[model samples]
Target: MSFGLFQREQRSLFGEILDWMLTPLLLLWPLSLALTWFVAQGIASKPFDRALEFNLQALTQFVVGQNGQVSFNLNAQARDLLRADDSDLVYYQVLDSRSQLISGEPDFPPPRDFETPEPGRVLLRDDLVRGDEVRVAYTWLARPDPERLVLMQVAETKGKRSTLAAEIIKGVMVPQFVILPLAVLLVWLALVRGIRPLNELEQRIRARKPDDLSPIEESAIPQEVAPLVSSINDLLARLTASLTTQRRFLADAAHQLKTPLAGLRMQAELAQRETDPVEIRGSLQQIARSSARATHTVNQLLALARAETTGRTLPSARIDLARLVRGVVQESVPRALEHGIDLGFEGPDHMPDDCLMDGNPILLQEMVRNLVDNAINYSGRGGVVTARVLLDPFSGVQILQVEDNGPGIPENEREFVLQPFYRALGTNVDGSGLGLAIVQEIAQQHGATVLMEDAHTDRSQRGLRAAVRFMPKTPRQE
Candidate 1:
């Protein structure tokens, strides 16, 4: 069968290409053999047919019709020469227009599917004479006006023709019979050699340690496989980043937990020593506070871990930021009241929704809560803290902002605020210092950028504005 370029292709590159090349060669081989046989038969018959025609002309010249009867005078020498073929038996016949044999073989069969030939024109065909396959050539000899015609026919067995055809077929087909298998062997060897590099690459990969998430080398890889290697490298790089984040989180968590647990043990010991109810009560309160701080720090570490891990594997859906932020604000209201800080939600309220973002809602809620909690914790008594979800009309950016009119972080220390366990100098806030770090991690997971700046309508006032701008993923409708 012929191969089409657009047919359903196979995964095996070697097999696909070999099929295209080999199928046509095998299909056409038999046709080539048949054509060669036909050519050989034509070559074998040419001289023999001409010799028969010459003998017929000689026999026709001997015919004397002056007595109104045909006479054949083919001498013994001419008959011996005609029958001299060593490889094939020869026969001849001469007949008059009345269908009576004038001389020669009486048992020679006439041609099947016969048509009368023009006078003096020779014709050749195959026939069975005396139950033997033979080739025949004949001519009709006419003697002018009244059309006195004589038929001279010669027949020869097919042994010589069969032998010559066999020779020609052998000459044309023997080399192909030998070369076809050799060609297949060469093609197979070439395929094996060409695919060896890929096998080597697979072996190299299999030989590597399980922990070896490093990139595969590209310099030695073929151009066709380079893209696959590059993609693997990209995945490795992302995995390295994720692994690094986990390691850092675990280390920071251990360090953060140590201080709070130590304080709790010290406070517990002091409470045991105190006999007075008031002193013991104070020690117990300190122990409770330390335990709470440790718990808070542990929870923050876990949140950061989830942010880093889920970013790559999780599927997100459309989250209503306005609704999520509203819940977070309501939960923080008591804490805001206790701090004597005015914590309020700004932007469009629960009626007509705003700030729709594509993200994991659980992670996003934690992010919003962290930002608001950080603001309230630092915004001393009687300070104003505003939480907002704003959308820019021109840029179509969805922004979540937490601003507080409190003692803000200095310009240089702003960068450190996002680092785990890092607090601004001289801050009297009661916190584990993981809020901003958690906020930064979650913002990264959501494809948003965080910015810290002075939150002041006038330069005279000092505070901080923490804004997270969510870039647009789809075109905004007017």
Candidate 2:
């Protein structure tokens, strides 16, 4: 099967260069030939025409009127002068004003009336004479005797004229034929020299390790190629970041899985040796809780992976922010009730008029769930976890704020907490620590901004507050 242009095997850089260089050169050859032929014909015909006019003038001088009668005369030297070359036979004729031949061949026809013939006009015409093709020149002559007007005609065979024209054409075209190929060769060489850097770049990429996501060096790259290299470097930087995140996730999963498996083993041993039924039941219960936490951690890790890979084949679309927030709160309410934490959605019943954003709904929901779940897990029983979506009129920003009355993070440690697998100190809660990182990634994908701050009420006590601000779709009216 034949491949399309894009899928075809790549041509050598040199070959591609040669094709472009030679194409125009080849195309111009025919044009050059045509132009050369035109110029050659003009050059050959001009002198011939001048020679015929000179012969006509010489014959005019020989005309004399004696006793009121016209006659023609020619000298031996003039005849010899006219027969200068032996390349082709020459013929001449003179006719009187009565359209009758006065001298030379009787079969020669009189000159036709030219549309705009001027005095002393000399023009070339083609004719068949004695079964041979000839080039002819004609001119009108005037004598002092009013009734003695004469027309002088000169003719030569085509062989001599054609030979002269061929010689001129060859001289002009032969040099160009040689020079054009040389120019094409030079152009091919220059193109090869120009494309060397691209080949070097390809070689550099091929030599790298599969896991090497380092940026390509831009110092030696040509200015024309710098943008392409910069784009590749940007992609490499993102891939490096992704690989680093994956490594951290793997390490965190191993650490998190080890603790639960060990606890389960210990619980099983205790249950096997227990004497009282209540003690055995308590050990089994502890094992079940540890198992549940382990399962939950596994599920979160899977969810994070899905969130990362989602939207690869799908495009973001307009999502209703208020509805998405409510849905997330509703799903997490059962968990919130288990801890007796108050989970409520505080936003417009319907999305505020004209409040919409381009986003992937599933990922957005995951982002909201992670933020609210973190608040619920951190806050104590009877603590208020308020999920608020507000559209600010002045700034034209849509804000989703989840504020919990739990001990807030220290200011210095807030930024560090966003790193994958980073857990706050002294928190006994079970989590993979990927919640905030996932929140940050999802927010970034939607072009939103995430900020963490201390929600202080009494100017002394600090509470946790995480806000994701979505930039407004349109400017607010005055």
Candidate 3:
């Protein structure tokens, strides 16, 4: 039962709109023709019907009463005049109350429901005369006696009415054949003009330079297409931000690598020049230190790059934050002992289901490792570093914190410390300043926030406390 009027895998907007507009007009044209033909027939038959009624009235005058009997006396001139018609043959009948034909054709059929005839009233009907359909107009005439009457009827063949109706149909329908196509063409032109804006938009996009990320102007766009334009503009804005971030990351990485690479090159040249065995060994030691620092810087750069990439492209799963923090702390114990720093973990022995959060395990572990390593390096010998994970029962927010007995970052430089290659003043730590930046990037990916504050409120022991606050898990995540 489906018309499937607009079936297409990839439909054209112009074609869809045109089909909707023209389908109804094309369908209704035939119905319009039918109605016009019906109306034309009625219009053509009116004049002929009036003529038959006039002739019927004229024939009634010939009726007369004589000696309590009805008769019709018509002269030859009047009868000849009545019969004079170029397109149709006319027939007439005169009958008495007893159903006796007194004059004219005796074969005329009686009117339907004519048993109680109203005297002196003319009525018109269609009936068959000699097997040919004709129009009949009939009337009753009163006699001198109140109970007696005469019936007069005049009928004519339908030849004249049929010819006029055909003429009217041709006059009305012949012009429409020429006009329909022209109307469709006008509609097509209108639709083309209406959708010209979208075509212009496509051209504008194609003509733009590859580096051009500017937004399209919204003022000139139609209200109907405003949403589409707005969405494209939003995409362009995000692409610009991503490109800017990549460019900055590359420039910062190049600048940071240059320092350690230059150091390694200089130390290598000095070791090659040394002739004394003691001097050679000392230069070799310095070269080893430079090489180690270069290796560490390269590794930090790679870690930062991985954290950013994983944030954007990696999928996440449910993980227990408490267990993850404990593992990272345990693994860092050897490194802590090498620096003579005491590192410990604190959290629930068995993590509850509510403490689980959704994240990339590899990235989250890298984030914790950077935080613990940074704490141990800055805390130095005999320093205490504690890593802990705790869950807020009421709010369901998960918290991961690394507290160290290192000089806290000044309040003014706390925000800057999270940016890559930024280090606090007067700190002698030999490390790339990328740990906090990696921590921040990973935290943001998991919908968490990072806070840098003092572990101890007292001014005498102002140790640093780096805390990450994870947003409450939704029911779906649980």
Top model by TM-score, which number? 2
All candidates' TM-scores? Answer: 0.75, 0.84, 0.78
> Per-residue lDDT for 1-478 in model 2, tens only?
2222222266554565566567666877899899889888888877776776676667666766567555667688658645747687778787766666766777775556653434467777888678777777877666545545667777777676688899998898789879887887788678878888989999999999997888999998889999999999998888888888778778888898889889999999999999999999999999999899889778778877876777444577888888889988999999999999998989886665556677888888889999999999889888889999998767668899999988778878899787777888878877878899889878877778889998875758757889998986567676
The sequence of per-residue lDDT tens digits that candidate 1 reaches over residues 1-478 is: 2263425544566667777767777777788888888998898777777776676666667655655777777677666747747788878888887779998898877655558658878788888988888888887877432376777788888887788778888887899899989997898788889888899999999999988998999999989989999999999999998788778867877888999999999999998898999999999899889989888888887877677666667778878777788889999999999989998999766423344667888888899999988888888889999999887766668888999988888889899999888889898777777888888988887789889999986778979999998987777677
lDDT of 3: 0.86
Candidate 3: minimum summed lDDT over ten consecutive residues — where?
Answer: 1-10
Give Cα distance to truth, residue 335, candidate 1, Å.
3.6
Report how far residue 101 has shifted in candidate 3, in Å: 7.9
Off by over 4 Å in 3: 1-11, 59-159, 217-231, 267-313, 350-358, 473-478
Worst 10 residues of 2 by lDDT: 1-10
lDDT of 3 by residue, 231-331 (tens): 99999999999899989988887888888788778878887888888988887788788788878888988888888775778888889888888888989
Residue 441 in model 3: lDDT:
90
Q: For candidate 3, list the clashing residue pairs, or say none.
A: none
The order of the candidates by TM-score, greatest first, is: 2, 3, 1
Ranking by lDDT: 3, 1, 2
